[model samples]
Target: MKLYKEKLLSELQLKRLGEHQYSCSSCSYLDKFLQPYWNWLVSKVPLWLAPNLITIVGLILNIVTALILVWYSPNAKDGAPRWACALCGIGLFAYQSLDAIDGKQARRTGTANPLGELFDHGCDSISTVFVALSACIAVQLGNHPGWMFFQCFCAITLFYCAHWQTYVSGTLRFGRVDVTEAQVTIMLILAISAIFGPDIWSTKIPGTVMEMKTFLMITACGIAAFVAQANISVIFTGGIGKNGSSVAGTSVLSPIIPFSMILVPAFIIYQKSTEHVYENHPALYILAFGLVAAKVTNRLVVAHMTKSEMDYTDLSLIGPTMLFLNQYFSTFITEYYVLWLCLVWVTLDLLRYCYQICTEICDYLHVELFRIPHTGNTNTKRISSTSTSGNTEKNGTNIRNNKPPRSKKK
Candidate 1:
């Protein structure tokens, strides 16, 4: 009888062990791939001097580079003091490295935060503006036409808008692993070519085919515009019909909106791509025309909303109305810097609100907003083991030792 009881208990324990083994394997797959690298880095570096410090270092380097570019602008006219340019290049390279290192360090230390993400993106935006401005200054000193300043300004503005659209839509992505590295290589080639003149490369390759820098810039702009528009469309569509009203009408308008957003930028890209010739592509022209019409319609809707009275208690309604009014006033009357600063503050506040909403949703669903390591599996195992032990004790006590011995009568 004791032998049978022991065999039964052993079987139950084996089954429980098997279940746990399966659960642990399934739960740890993702962590398994990353854990080795993470552990190695954590062992090497103190937590206090990890990712955040890298970000700060990157920010300082970028700021110094911007300042140097501004200071060296006058001397850039005699073809930018080679040493200053070299320093700027070195700073840019360092900035990129630190940018990459911060994320790596964060992953290694398992210390990523929402605030870190926000700060990283915000700093990147600021860095882009500084870098573009510096480049504009250098170009101006290089005897380029004053109009090139406007071109650079427009290019930078479009790039920022595209980046923001993707970020807000939750498709914010980086191409540093491939495209950015390739771009750096291309820039190196361009710097070398610039020193020797475009004529040197033009001789080896046909002049028409070898518009290297122009082609590269235009291609980059085109790709960025395309991706931005695609992601924006996805976001707009997803948000549609979520509020009280059906977004059917809005949905109908969505396909045309992105085209309008990219129209001017697309035209600029095409013109640059084709070397400033006005080659009429009917489809592109229609796309440009459609964008203008959409913009006009959007403005009309805004004007209508602003002119109407809205109940203050309806915060959702009032908020949008206030935003429209602010936008209108800022565009027509307010100092540009003041308007921009206000807008930035508002954007940040809105992001904070959205994050709170997401947190609430995750809580309601009983799921994590971001991955939490091992907690779920650990809890499940603890519960299972406790329950199994309780069942075994209950069954063991219920068994009558004298009754069990009666089986030996056969």
Candidate 2:
């Protein structure tokens, strides 16, 4: 009996080795000046206000900003009025302020927890799309479908890569020039757009015929390539982890497969929708962007909370690239046919992915994934620090005690 208990305890310890504690390293030049403003703003907020509520408010502002852009720019080609850029700029600025303040509120209220981090990140992921699409509209990039697709793809992929780097390296890195810096640049561009009318800004570059929007797109692509390359190098070379080891196996591409596959249906649906109902409807494009943003955000929440590695895979890029290429070539294939096929593929894969993550988290916590407590609320309670540690120890004890005894007969 003594030997059995010892062996059981060992197994329990291994099973209860919970996720790595979160860590981050940031070098923000703007924060040096912005910190004082942020501190003052956070001080005015009541302590009773929850941090997640702040995140939700930020998200709503993002949606509203996108809506404003769509409403004013009914024809995607003619572009939104110059003043609309000012509204989007205001909305995005508010979003950034709210997003930054939430962490401070969490610290002030003594409610900082992993769930809060997850919630904040989830909001940021979705907000990325809204902000990107809004900026695209403000600059009139949406007038060119190719550039529009490229811009959105780069923005979304940039976000995914950042999280992917964090998940694998066990460190969230904010380089000297990061998303915050890029955002400031974008805001400046929007301000310029508002100050100088779109027609004037759309004029050819000083020395070149390329428009400012195209130049901005090119610059963005270059920056994205650099950032993606750095993260990909760290993934393949095993440079960032403790003791310099890779988090994923030799096949670094497999994990990205699921995320990429999920977008297949979205691409097809987007194409058909654009062809039929959204060709002239700019608002639908914003709505489409929001749907994708929501889906990707949900996926990231599951990935981060579960501490899963998101692989660096090219397969995920192939579908979107191919679809875009087909559009560029004006393919004869009917989009509806492809859309139906992609619908089936995406549904099956999404269900499987959700079920797998749900089962893993539930089993890890030793609790029902969707269980409603006697409290009669379905909303998920934040995983407090005490409960997290307690659950680990409790799960370990239950597993150890549940082991069957060896047969008496020998």
Candidate 3:
């Protein structure tokens, strides 16, 4: 706790945060078709249920199911049980349904704010890593680590680039076949694995000598490359901010340094390892690096919303640096143990950053994290810091407005 004594957001950033609005342009073909279903699903949720609760629950479900798969096939090369794959499919579907409705729940309850957007995207950055990992395991992609590395990093890169574009243009853009399609395809792949077995992915294509899994990997990687290029092109075409800068009024290309710091070091460590560290423990290696990537992505989201420049330097870099230096020491410590230490370090760092940032935001907005301040009934006295400070500020554009009820004359 002492580590987070300093404020993460500056006064200027906090002031500009109120001016931020969530602007998204999604041309998702699948989501367009599923609109009515998503609307109907959210309608079933009770009024008292908190939006952040909905999001966290979905994220937990996704993580738990993915972990179940990891427990069985830690290396991704081992074939997982049929039941586990089926369970993962169900869990992913639940997560998708619940994640889709949190925003609606917030709006319905009059608790819509920048916090909701930040929380939602923060959940997504982590979820992307798990989702990609689970898909790789489902296809038994561990046998081919080269493809596995490309596939997992490709997914991560595309996710980062999407938000990078948002940081530049001040609007999130989605093409026709984006996240929704990829998720649905993965869900189906898991379902097929559960039914026909993981070995089915090794079968040759109907008319071609290529394996089924290879085709899948190649196609997904190609699509990811195309999308990432599109994002960079949007950045190159210039931004929507003043003087063609990012939403934070910084140079549009500035984000490249932070992200490259992550990807470049990861590639170097993976290739230069004398003990074949990543090849021996693929899942653990990916998860550690994935968490680091997620942390950086979350910072990018915050910078865009706060209209503040994102610092390329981060404490999370300590994890990668430790590994890189360990390899340089000529086997001073077993690489496996070092990888585990790296994972633990990055995880705690992520949690700490999230806690401090959310605490600061909640205090500033006079709102609670998961609870809606009840103001309709006078006798319904819910006493807490959030409730007491509910009347702090109700005029801000993107901040929540907590209002008490008016009295009636007899």
Candidate 4:
């Protein structure tokens, strides 16, 4: 008996230990970091102090930066004054930090619904467009031709699409941990360098060949292109399906879709590198024409297949075509128009994400339909029934009286 009891106790302890181990292994750092802040913000702040408010604040700051670069400052023709440039840089930095905070707050407070993540990323995307437009405005103020704005627009689109493709494919990693912090830092530095004049800024290298802005843009673009190609390869080769199945291509031409997707961007990047052309250079305009040709040829090859047969092939083709079109638009669009367009795209995306989050929250709570509770009436009725039953028992009286009690009814 003693041995059995000891064994049972030991088993209970082991079970608890296993449960604790599992919990620790599954703990998320994001939850830990954001939870406290979320609690404090919600409890301390006014109802009006919400995530959207933070987004608006960030947008306002971004717009102010753009306006300062466009209208005021003696060096508007070259860029903004050193002070205005500094202000813009500071504002951008703050905006990014707050952008992060809103999401963290949402997650920590158990409010990390899909809508919050969507709203946060949507805001981020819009902010990206705004930043690009501001750069265009600055460039225009600096006496650069209006066409340069198109280049900025293209760069933004490329970045956005690359991220989107990666997100969809589940291969999109942002920084060291596959988050967006590193990318944001890179963007901030690029913005700062542009403000300071790309040519004038130099790092610790004894003799670096590339200017700061040029190097930043090239590096960011190169990374984006590489990630995009990797996602395309995974998608087309069916190397990894969304449902975790491997798909074998039935036709020899099936592989070509992903092949072109990866190769075309690669060829463009290599061509740009060898010719010493930046992403926004006139060369991209020519490259866009070539990509369009490639896209048309690929479509023609797969055009004859049945809808179901062509589904996979079509999926592969869409990304390349979109990339080409994006590049074309970037190369051809006017600066002033591109900036506003980007801004509008960002705003709409943000709103869509917020709505999505709210819907998710409602679903999670299982409160699709509103229901009211009558706590007072239900509690009062329960209490009255209990009191009457107690009184009947004490008085030797049964309410039902189906059978006689030994001492009373008999």
What lDDT does candidate 1 reach at residue 20?
Answer: 27
Candidate order (lDDT): 3, 2, 4, 1
- lDDT by candidate, in order shown: 0.36, 0.55, 0.80, 0.36
lDDT leader: 3
Task: Supply the TM-score for candidate 3.
Answer: 0.91
- Clashes by residue pair, model 4: 77-142, 115-357, 174-178, 174-179
Candidate 1 stretches with Cα past 4 Å from truth are: 1-47, 74-78, 136-147, 166-168, 174-217, 238-410
Candidate 4 residue-wise lDDT, 1-410, digit = tens = 33112121133322222121000011223323444554454455343345445655765786577456545422223444555555666666656545545533332222222223223444454455445544443333223323333344344444443332322232322222122333244345546555665334434334766544455455545655654564455444432333533221234234345434544553453243432232233223222322332222222221211111222232223433443444556545443233234334433433443454334433433222112123233422211121222112222211111100110000
Question: lDDT per residue, candidate 3, 1-410, as tens digits?
Answer: 56544999877776666556556555567766776887798899998888889988988999999999999998998999999999998888888888777766765776666676778788888888899999999999999988898888888888888888889998777777788788899999999999998999999999999999999988887888778777889898759788998987789999989999989988999999999998888899899999999999999989988888899988888999999999889868989999999999999999999888888877766667888778674332322222223224322211122211100000
- Report lDDT (Cα) of residue 351, candidate 3: 93
- Candidate 1: worst-modelled 10 consecutive residues by lDDT: 401-410
**Candidate no. 2 TM-score:** 0.68
Given candidate 1, what's the lDDT at residue 381? 31
Number of the top TM-score candidate? 3
Candidate 2 differs from the real structure by a C-alpha RMSD in angstroms, to one decimal, of 12.1
What is the lDDT, from 0 to 100, of the residue 242 in candidate 1?
37
**Distance from true position, residue 17, model 1, in Å?**
40
- Give per-residue lDDT, candidate 2, residue 142: 54
Q: Over the full model, what C-alpha lDDT does candidate 3 score relative to the true structure?
A: 0.80
All candidates: TM-score: 0.43, 0.68, 0.91, 0.44
